[model samples]
Target: MKNISKIFMFLLIIAIPQIAFAESSKIGVVDLQKVLNESAKGKEAVKLLEVEFEKKKKELDIKENDIKKLEEEISKRGSLWSEKVKQEKEEDYDKKVKDYRRLQTDLKDEFQRKNKNFTDKILSDIIELVRTVGDEEKFSLIMEKQNAIFTSSTIDITDKVIKLYNGKEKGEK
Candidate 1:
């Protein structure tokens, strides 16, 4: 009788972990990149950025044209110009080119900084929404789909997250 009780105790101990695991909340996956691409706010943000970039590109093109014309004029009058005057003109052109390059660099840096900030803000909001959904759905863990090679549809929460995010953005509860 004592041997039977000991055997039962060992079996119970082994079964406890399996039972706990079976009852535990499941891990869910979300494709964050897909969410961002499909979200309405994300699409709008992308369009705005593209427009701003195009404007800056146009401005740069104008500056480039001006520099090219200056160089052409200088070359055309080279035969009639004094060596010192030619050197001065070349120096002025070089300075303008340098300044334009600096401006280009600054613009690029500013664009990158702004883009990063914008994306970070959006991602933060999305993360909050994801957390809320996970909590409501009793998810034990929520992983990014990008990190996972495969996940069952039962555990995929991408659409739910996107819907929640967009709904919040639209002032929907």
Candidate 2:
């Protein structure tokens, strides 16, 4: 009977660890890039940026046309004009060209700034939504999808994040 009791105790010790390992931690992942691309708020922000881009492009186009016309005028009539007059026209054209280039640079910088601001805001909103989902679902860990090389499809919560982001956007409006 003592031998039987010792055998049962050994079996119980082995099974105890197995039972502890049976309960798994709930982990979730979110694809932030996909959320930014697929979400409605992201799309709207893109559209607004595009509109601003087109507007700047048109202004640049008009300035470019003006430059081309000035160059053509100099080519056609520069030889007949006084040296002083030709020099002045050349200076004017140079200044205009410089201004156009500067404006182009400024527009690009502005666009980048605006894009960063938009992304920062959106990313924060996503983080908030992720936290909410994690809390509600009782997830033990929520990781960025890009960080994981191998995750089950069941653990991917990017779609859930996008859905929540869009819903939150709607509520704000």
Candidate 3:
């Protein structure tokens, strides 16, 4: 057992230099969310998305108000209303609720689709930019800043990536 321990220590000593060398590799970190928030194209995309969101919000609000009014009427006058009338009102309310729920789901899906499109395009461009930067700057590895804990500013290439990505976005526009 002692001989095995000695051999293990010997192997560990031999591996130290390789571990040190690996740590010395040219690694970079990029803050992709920062790039998306600060870049011109990203700003434009957000603004457009917000417009769509607001437009849908207005429609939902109007429908919601109508539903509220109907509910109030049913509640206040339902006792005096004929049985058939009360039943019709209840059915109408139910249908409106169903429509509202369906519309909400549809809007959510539409927003997600738009968001995915923007993200997919932006991420694809960022990947290409990262590749170019990696090749030009001779980076051995690049990781997202979101996953990092204590990366030195010297290895933070987020600004460069954003600049390169924005340049490409400008050219494409």
Cα RMSD to the true fold for all candidates: 3.4, 4.8, 3.7
The CA lDDT of each predicted structure is 0.86, 0.92, 0.90
Clashes (N, CA, C under 3 Å) per candidate:
0, 0, 0
| Model 2, span 1-173: residue lDDT tens | 99999999999999988777656568899999999989998898889999989989899999999999999999999999999999999999999999999999999999999998998888888999999999999898999999999999999999988988999999999
lDDT of 3: 0.90
Look at candidate 2 and tell me the lDDT of residue 21: 62
| Model 3 ranges with Cα > 4 A deviation | 1-24
Give the deviation of candidate 3 from the true structure as CA RMSD.
Answer: 3.7
Q: Which 10 successive residues of model 2 have the least lDDT summed? A: 17-26
TM-score of candidate 3 to 2 decimals: 0.84
The model with the greater TM-score, 2 or 3, is 3
lDDT of 1 by residue, 1-173 (tens): 99999999999999999899878957999888888888977887788888888898899889888889879978999668999989998998898799889879988998898788778888888888889888888888999987888889988888988887888888953
What lDDT does model 1 reach? 0.86
Best by TM-score: 3
How many clashes does the backbone of model 3 have?
0
Stretches > 4 Å off in candidate 2: 1-22
Candidates 1 and 3 compared: the better one by lDDT is 3
Question: By lDDT, who's the top model here?
Answer: 2
